[model samples]
Target: MTDQPAAESTTTITLHLWLDVVCPWCYIAKRRVQAAIGLFERPHDVTLVTRSWELHPDLQPGTGGPVDHDARVPGESVAPGEQRVRIEEAAVDHEIRFEWARAVRANTFDAHRLCALALELGGPALQSAMVERCFAAHFTEGLALDDHDVLQRISAEAGLDERRVAAVLASDDYAANVRADEEAGRRLGATRVPFLVANRTASASDLQSVEDYLGVLREVVTESA
Candidate 1:
């Protein structure tokens, strides 16, 4: 018999991402992660597990002001106009459209719950679609993240079951999952949004470039191999 080469074994890398829906930085970081994954050698072997992190968790749901140059979380101080400028500059090449004039700063708890529901019902792909929808609605389309009707429409757009989504919105379904995700992020020493971890070992924080994310993914892949 002719000798044959051994088959390559695939190793799975679990990537955990903690983000808030309203965070512009998180949106940018997410795009960077996706870009890095596309450049990875074994992209299919990598699994993304999205988690929840609330930048303004204590803010009342459905209560928010119009997003503007001066918009900021209560009790947190920042130089006026600096934030908008900085984020716009950072996101210039990432295809993000701010639409800040029409944006609202509503609490993202309900959106996080909807994401949890997506994760429960369909897994990471579906959950990512749900998150992307929420992000686009809030950031690009200028929709309120906490509005139930908008959420219903978003959920439907993401191909989730309408009845289940309605149930999730009417009641507190997946709230515990959302809380657990936040608690997990806190335990991981994450003090801010857009926290990412690969293989439960390597981690990166806000605003890292795509190359930085690619480096972290390479470390995970190499160590696993």
Candidate 2:
């Protein structure tokens, strides 16, 4: 009788990230998580999933400008000027070029829809590239994410088919997927952008260091083992 080969064991860990295109913290959090993932032993076993979390869902597509600092952090004792300084200082630590003065606050629904399409058509690498471009466009370049032209350029830059991306932008393709992501985020009790869920076992919404992410990943691995 021929000897039978042993079955190969496989382990996969899903890291779900709920984020908004216009959120600066989400950009920072992404960088931190990426850095941590580089340090992980089983990086190939992990899959990063980006989910939609609209920060300003009610805002119109064309009506975009600098975000109202005071309006965002209501009831806080900190003055807007002081808050700006503090936020800029913190962003420097993450190597993020936060051009808040030129930042445009707009509806990110369409951008989220594009992300969903990226995942469907191009998989995680393309989705990740799309997410990074969206964040950079909003926070670094201070571009309006709601603009279809901008989205098209970003989509093309991320290696998506221009014709397909244009079709998606022209129609309501993947709109339901965007809404589903939002609903799932709500069910997970994620009220803030940059929220991360590791293996659906651990989660956090606040700004965390690379070590913090590593710790969470290690815990998930241990539990799965």
Which parts of model 1 are misplaced by more than 4 Å?
1-9, 68-79
**Residue-by-residue lDDT tens digits, candidate 1, 11-50:** 6788899998888888888888988888877789888878
Candidate 2, position 198, lDDT: 86
Candidate 2 segments exceeding 4 Å error: 1-10, 69-79
Candidate-wise lDDT, in order:
0.83, 0.79
* lDDT string, candidate 2, 1-225, tens digits: 111212232557789989887776677778888877788776787888899989898998899777764434312467556766655654676677877777888899989988988898889889999998898888778789999999999889988889999999989999999889889888988877778898788787766777788777776766655
Structure candidate 2, residue pairs in collision:
none
Candidate 1 TM-score versus the reference: 0.89
Clashes of 1: 0
